[model samples]
Target: EPEVTQTPSHQVTQMGQEVILRCVPISNHLYFYWYRQILGQKVEFLVSFYNNEISEKSEIFDDQFSVERPDGSNFTLKIRSTKLEDSAMYFCASSGLRSTGELFFGEGSRLTVL
Candidate 1:
């Protein structure tokens, strides 16, 4: 089955540095989303993109953050200024249809900010 894939399963970065987490969403899907889970916290939606534009974004997706679909298969999340609280598991998800509300997620890209 086609699946979402994320790179650099683990990353350690200093606070205030820039980081780009990469993801390749499942082919043939129309909607993509990014979510983050802080240690001991529930998964929080960061943003959702479709048709090359942002569909929705949570408050957590502040000015320092941006997302792009650089190609037909690649979606990327960039953080301009990381913070200690940015340490979390970043998950990339794709869904074939928004009506079903079913999402397939990558294993996750773990980020550690110190």
Candidate 2:
């Protein structure tokens, strides 16, 4: 079975630094998303991309955050400036349909902001 893969399972960065988390979602999936979990907090949606454009995004995806599908097989999330509160486990997900309620997720890239 195909699955999402993320690079750098763990990352530690200082405050105000830039961070880029990478992911390769299943090839056949059409929609992709970035979600984050702040330690013990609930999972929060950051952004979604489809057809090479941003489909939707949450308020947490502020000016500092950006998503891109730079090629045929990769999806990426970039945080221009990291903050202490930005430390979290970022998950990359893909699905065939938004209403299907089923998303395939990666193991997650952990980001630690000092």
Off by over 4 Å in 2: 97-99
On lDDT, the leading prediction is 2
Tens-digit lDDT track of model 2 for 2-106 = 999998899999999999999999998999999999999999999999999999999999999999999889999999999999999999999985569899999
Reference-based lDDT, each prediction? 0.95, 0.96
lDDT of 1 by residue, 1-114 (tens): 888999879999999999999999999888999999999999999999999999999999999999999988999999999999999999999999556879999999999999
Please name the candidate that would achieve the greatest TM-score relative to the true structure: 1
Clashes of 1: 0
State the lDDT at 27 in candidate 2: 91
Worst 10 residues of 2 by lDDT: 94-103
Clashes of each: 0, 0
Each candidate structure's TM-score, on Cα atoms with residue i matched to residue i, is: 0.97, 0.96
Candidate 1 Cα errors over 4 Å, as ranges:
none
Q: Please, what's the RMSD in Å of model 2?
A: 1.1
Candidate 1, pairs of clashing residues: none
